[model samples]
Target: MPSLSPPPVDKPSDATTAQTTEAETKPHAQPDSDEPINSLDPQPIDESKPKSNLDLVNECDSFPYFQSTPQLYLNHVSTYYHLRVAAYPEITLGYVLPSVAEVLRGLEEWELDDDERTLTLKAGDDEPTRSAILARTTAAMREIGHFSILKGWRNELYPVYGPAPARDLLFSIERAASALFGIVTYGIHMTAYTKSESGELKIWTPRRSKTKSTYPGMLDNTVAGGMATGENPQICCVREASEEASLPEDLVREKAHSAGTVTYFHIRDSRAGGETRLLQPECQYIFDLEVPSDVEPKPSDDEVEEFYLMGVDELKEKLKAGEFKPNCAVVLLDFFIRHGVLNAQNEPDFIEIVSRLHRKLDFPTA
Candidate 1:
C-alpha cells in the first residue's frame, strides 16, 4: 500500500503575502503562505454595510453558485448524464460526464440505456459482484492515465449505499473518483472547544500542511476524515481525533457528542485537485468535542502544520475573511447556531442559514 504521509513541508518563501497564503479566502486560493491569521486582533466591522454569514453557507452549498433555479442547475449539467446499476434500474446511482460516459460505453462492464442519457453497470444482484465490476472499471480508467483526478488516487474505498428504505450496500468506489461520479459521500467533522469558568468559549482550529493535495495550508476542524467502508460515524471521529489531533481515543469517545450533520452539494474548484467544476454532493456527520482547559491539540501527522485556539470574536473575523475551508466554515457556523452564538436576534437570515445547512440531497445517504 502507498504511504499516507504527505511530502515534507516546503521551505517558507521570503516574499509570501497574506493574499497568496491566506486559507480558503477564495475557493481556489493558492497555498504559498504558512502565517496564521491572528484571531486576537479583530477587524473593524463596516457598520455601513453589514455582511451576512449566509454568503459562507451559499459558497459551500454551491449548487446555487450561479444564482440559478433548479431547472437552470440541471441545464448547466447538460454535458453529464445520470448513472444507474442494473440491480436497481428505477433509482439513479450517480452521474457521468460525457467523456467518462464515452469510456464506459466502450467497456463491456457498462450497458448504455436506450435513451443514451443513462449508463448502467451490468452486474449480479450481490454486493460483491457490483463492487468487483466498479473496482475493475475504475482500475482500468486509472491505468489509462488520461484522467487527472485518478492521478491522486488515495487507494481508499468509500461505500455507496442504496437509496432510502433500502439500506443494503450497492457498491464501493475509489475515494478520489467519488466527486467525479457526483455521488453523495460521507465524512465526519468534529469541533473541539473549551468553555471557561466565565462562560467564554474558544475553539481549536488546525492549519493544514502546505504539502497536502487538497486545500493545502488551509484551516480545518479539530478532527476530520472521510468515512471508510464498514466504519460508523463515531468510530471515524475517534480514529481521526487520534490520527489528526493526537488525542487519546478514550478521551475522544468520552467527550465527543453527536451534533447531527451538515449536508452540502459542492462543485470542485482548482484547489480540490481534480477536474474543475465536477459535482461532489457530500454529507458531513458532525460532532462537538468539549475538551478540558488543560488539553491542547497538536499536529500528529504531516496533514497538519499547527493548531490555534481562538475566541469566538476572532473566529467570526476569520470567517468573514474566508480563512477556513468552505465546508469547515459551514460546520463552524452550525456549531455557532447550536451553541446559541448565532440567532434570529443578531442574524437576519437565521432561518435561511439553518435551512441551507440541512439541504435535502437528491442522492442516497447513510
Candidate 2:
C-alpha cells in the first residue's frame, strides 16, 4: 500500500524556461527559401489543400470581409445576425483572424455534438475580425446555414447526421483523417532524448514513414500541429518546434525546457474523401516538451522518418513492450514519472506500472 508520486520537480536551467512558443508573426511565409518546394522531378504537392479561410470565407457578390450589423430576434423565435458588410474567407490557410467566428445557426455539426450544432453568435458584430460563431454549434447541427463548399445541401446534409462537429472538417489526411472527423488537433508527446552519465536520460525512437500524412512517419511526438483558425496554444507550441526540429530559433527561444498537456481521440482516416467526407472528428490536445541536455534533435527528413536514442531504462523498456504510441506510451510514462526517472517497481517490469498508477491515484480508503 505504498504509492504516492507527486514530488520531484527541478528542471529549470535552460534560461528560466524560455517561453514564446510562436507569437504569431511568420505564420504564413516560411517554406520559401525559393519555393520550388523541392524538385528535379519529385512533385507531390498534390494540390487540393484549402479547407477554410480562402480570404476569411464569406462568399460572393462583393465579399470584402464583413461590416453589416442589424438583425435581432428572440421572442419572435430567436434569429439575430451580423458579419455581412463584405464577407471574409479569402484564404490565407484557414486561419489568421482577429474577427470572424460566430457564424452561427447550429454551428453546422460542430464535429458532431449535434444540439442542432449549437451557436449563438458574436466575433465581429459589425466588422473587424474576432470570429467565433460557427453557428449555434450544437442542438443537432446541420451545416450552420452556409459557407458553401459547393452548396445546395452540401451533399445531402453531409454528416448532418448529428452528435459531432465541435470541430472536424479536414479535407486532406489522405482523404481527410477519417472524414473530416471533428478537427482541432495538436499532439506532440515528444521524445528525442539525450543526457546520461548515471545522470541518465536517453530517448529517441522513430520508425513510421509510410510517406506520412499523420502517423506515417510515426515514431511519436516530433512536433505536431493543427490549431489553426485564429490559433494560440503558445502558437501551437512554437509551430511544432520549428516544423519538426533542427532546433535553434534561438534554441527554442533559449532552452526553456519542460512543459506539459495532453488530450485524445482518433480515427482510421479516409483522407479528404471528397472534400471532408462524412467526418468522425473527436480529438483534443497534448503538449509535453522538455529539452536541452545538450540539445541536438534535428530531424525533419520531411517530418521525422525515424531515429533512435534509448535510456530511462530504454523508455521503460519500450513502454513495457507495447512499443510506443498509446499516446506515446502515456507520454513517456508521464515524463518518466514526472522527472525522477521512473522508479516504482515490483518486478514484472514495474508491476504494470504499479497497476497503472494504482488506477491513477484514486487514494482514499482507510
Candidate 3:
C-alpha cells in the first residue's frame, strides 16, 4: 500500500515559489490534455477573453500541484482515488512507472485546518524541490504506466461524457484562468441468467444499497461503477461487478450477453457524496450480464444487502410496482426484451424495438 496522506491546503510562499521551480505545462502532463480535442484532455479554452484579479492570499492554491501521489484508499471505500498524469498511447519513458514510495520521503508535509475537509499537499521547499517533485512524479507515473499527473494547469474545464482516459487514474484541478478540473460519470447493470428446465435462459435481481449514492434501499440488477479517468465501459463493467459482487474477471470478460448503451443524459443521484462533488448527473453506460442460474452470487456488504431470483412474470410485477431503481429498471427491461427472454408485450416501447430488431434480422414476428 502507498502512503495515503496528501499535503494540507496552503499556497507556497516566496521561499517556496522562488526557491521552487515550475514545471513546463506540457500537453501530456494533464489527464485530459492530449493531442486532439476529441481525445482524453479537456477541450481548448478561448484565452482571448479578459482576466480577473480576485485574491488576498497566495497563487499556488489557484494552481495546485500534486506529486502524482497515489490517492488514499479511505476506510470502507472500494474505489481508489489518487493523482497521476492521464494515461494514453504516448511515450516518454518505457512501460512500468516508478512507485510513489520512491519519492515519499522528499515530500514536505502539512495538514489542513483541523476540521476542514479535503486533504491536500503543501510541499515546495524550493524551486528545485517543486520542479523535481513535479517532474519526478510525472516521470514516475510515466514509468508506472497507470496514469499521469497532468501538465498544463491553466486550462478551461469542460463537461465530458465518460472517463478522462481510457484507463483509471487520478489528477488534480485548481481554479485557474484555463479551468483545470472537470468531472466524468458512469453506470452499470447486472444481468443474471439461468437455464430453465427446458433449457431456456433468464436473469436474477438484487436489492440495492439503502446507503447507495442513488436509489437507496431499492432492488437492482447486479452492480455498477463509474469509469474514472483513463477507463472504459468494459473496464467499468469489470470494476463495478468486482465492487458489488464476487464476479471473476473471466465471467465479466466472457461477453455471453449484452444490452448495449442504455443511457440517461440528465439523470442525477443525490446520494453520491462529495467524491462526485455532488454533480451526480443522469449519465452512465448501462450493460446487462446474464449469469448461469445456479451460480451463487457474492455481493459486497457496503453496496448491497441481498437479492432474489424471479422469472419474467415476477420481474414484470416488480417493474410495474416501481420497486427498482429507474435506470436499473430501464436496463433490465431492455435486456430481457433484447435477448428474446421476454414476450415483448411489456409496453408499446418494447413491442416497437423488438419488432424493429426482429424484422431487421428477417425473423418472424411473435
**Predictions in order: lDDT:** 0.74, 0.32, 0.38
Taking every candidate in turn, the Cα RMSD to the unseen true structure, in Å, is 12.1, 22.4, 17.9
lDDT at 81, model 1: 53
Q: Model 1: what TM-score?
A: 0.83
Worst 10 residues of 1 by lDDT: 20-29
Q: Which candidate should be chosen as best, given lDDT against the real structure? A: 1
lDDT (Cα, tens digit) per residue for candidate 2, span 66-98: 113111001000110111111122111111011
- Segments of candidate 1 deviating more than 4 angstroms: 1-51, 65-68, 113-116
- Model 3 regions more than 4 Å off: 1-184, 199-201, 255-258, 267-283, 341-346, 351-366
TM-score result, candidate 3 = 0.44
Q: What does candidate 1's lDDT look like per residue over 167-253, in tens digits? A: 778888888878767778899999999999999999999999999888788789999999988999999999999999999899999
Clashes of each: 0, 96, 38
